[model samples]
Target chain A: MIDNTMNPFLIFISACLINNILLIKFLGLCSFFGLSSSIKNSVGMSLAVIFVTIMATVVSWIIFHLVLVPLNLVFLRTATFILTIATLVQIEEMFIKKYLPPLYKAMGIYLPLITTNCAILAVAFLNIDYNLNLLNSIAHGFGVGVGYTLAIILFAGLRERLMTAPIPKALQGYPVAFFLASLMSLAFLGFKGLFGL
Target chain B: MSKSNKPGISAPGTAAFLYGVLKGNPVLVLMIGLCPVLAVSTSIFNAVGMSIAVAFVLIGSNVIISLVRKRTPGEIRIPVFIIIISTFVTIVDYVIRAYSPELYRQLGVFIPLIVVNCIVIGRGEAFAYKNTVKLSFLDGIGTSIGFFIVLFVIGLLRQLFGKGELLGKVIFSKPALIMILPPGGFITIGVLMGILTYYNLKKSKV
Candidate 1:
């Protein structure tokens, strides 16, 4: 078990930089690579992820601590949490489509895709694995979302510039994108000893 | 587009199997379900463990989803598939924990994250949902082998360079420790992908 007494601020920084969900941990790469081709799409997807991940952390934490634990049904965590996230994404999409029409138009397409994003599920699992309380879990979730946004936005910007650069046909598309990610990942490694995390 | 009229075998079945292993490899060609590939591939041991676990879940879910495809309602097929896939993942999670605590610890949350792996669910929706049980089984095997092949190669390279060893045997004294780090994973995979694309492009031209 991790030390629960660690400050939430440190947790935020650690998750955001030291252990960035996309560049460092490699979670959510499908969307990281897919939606990151354009800055507009990446921003929309990141906004949706930020909304969904925090909500998921809150709900899953509550369920695990209150329901799954008391009922001794901890074995069902995987299935239960996935079902909850799937349902939540659906409800959130519907709610947004109804109330926030403009917001829905902006990020509506990415909601359904978020259901299978490993980052959201990984966040929920990490919250439980690290033994964080509700406040810390929320902080961690937000930090991870911000981390994802930062990486994807930066990546999209680079990819935009890459589109016009001369390149070998073999390395034209994803290969170059991956090499770019490798460089960014190497750069992000500089954050490892930050705050002695 | 060649159709097989040979007795006791079908062309589509062979095509399905070959597609996963070569044409539509989950890792190399399609680039889906890459989280585990990059995360646990620092060592061949962890890579093999992850491959086996994912293979089991993929095969199990594929077979079961193929079996129930006809009866499943079209509107809710995605949820149904998720449930089936998660069940197998949960089972694999405990089995690994009970049998090999070391592997379980090394794999950690990745075992559970397999539930969200795009390959398993993608296969269930794309191939298994419309194919016969036997063909789905073959597809599962072929896809697993493809996944295993890429994973094994990455693991081998990373282990050999990172630790100057292979499967716990020291091959050399000096090692590039960065090969085992996160950046190493990205760089190795990037180079590998570039090589694959180069070959494919050459093949097509020829």
Candidate 2:
């Protein structure tokens, strides 16, 4: 499954740019707008997304392949994915609180928010809907999360420095953010169509 | 959790409707659910279909959520919204698949993804719970229409220049590839937002 497939570099580029979950696909948007004000929080939020997405993908993959597929319960994908993600977030929250309290604090409210992050569930659905195997799913999840982190970090860095940048009267906070997202997405569009990896 | 800044609140209903259209703009101003917008807004027909589907679910969920608002616990309000939106989105998804397979193909996975759009949940939390059912319903339609109008405009303009046609025809010989790319979507929407804001500022001035 790993050796025989689409270009890994294309997967990375697609997740990061052409199929960007934020600017294009509109997944993980809550975190994009909420936690992007500071680089520290952006990193924390991105890390949290990475954790929830990877875990949720693995668990959901196991469930879908082991149980749902056999039962032909494909219609239940939405309900199942949502429940699995909520449960995953709860478990991760408890473990982090106990084993990594400082990191938990850094993530704080954003941790719980990951449960509602449609990106996690959306990626799982994409895996099944596209019928990718376990290895591909993991690679896809990792790539998307990294894509997410790249976007958040890029956005956070820009937004933080914007603290000193002058702006027009009405086009201050959100307008600037949206414009910046546009530019960043434009930059990412450059990565299209280079995948012989 | 709701920051109810209901100003002197005379006919807050109308104000809320207006807010969704411009002040709290879903696409341009708020920048929510842009994924489907940019992806589907290549043609007028696709945008119209997506808009109608979104409108149906948004209005349906808003009314349902408002009806259940009194019984819903605060701790679980969000989950409930999620479920309601998901259910409606699923229904739309299946119905679209069963009936309009062609449009379904065009919209692709985005139809099902309507569940995750922040605009729906945001509408539920911000307007549906606080207002009467009637107000909530109106607000939903108004906001959805506003969203639809914007998507339609963007789609129409893009198709016109990008493809040299309005819907799918090729009204002109030379089409602009820039209008079909990611950067094109951003530039068009950015300029549209600027113009809209300028008009908004002018109107508010009067």
In model 2, what is the error at residue B162, expressed in angstroms?
1.9
Cα deviation at A139, candidate 1, in Å, is 0.4
Lowest summed lDDT across 10 adjacent residues in model 1 chain A is found at: A1-10
Which runs of model 1 end up more than 4 angstroms from their true locations?
B1-11
lDDT of 1 by residue, A1-197 (tens): 22468788888888888899998898999999888889999999999999999999999999999999999999999999999999999999999999999999999999999999999999999999999999999999999999999999999999999999999888888889988998898899899888878
**What C-alpha lDDT values do all the predictions have?**
0.90, 0.77
RMSD of 1: 3.4
Query: Global CA lDDT of candidate 2, please?
Result: 0.77
TM-scores for candidates 1 onward, in order? 0.96, 0.86
Compute the DockQ of candidate 2: 0.38
Query: Pairs clashing in candidate 1?
Result: none
TM-score of 2: 0.86
- Give per-residue CA lDDT, model 2, range B1-206, as digits (tens): 11223323234677767766765667766666666777788888899999999998999999999899999989888778878888888888889899999999888777777877767877887778766788788788777877988999999888888889754555978988777766677667766766776776788899
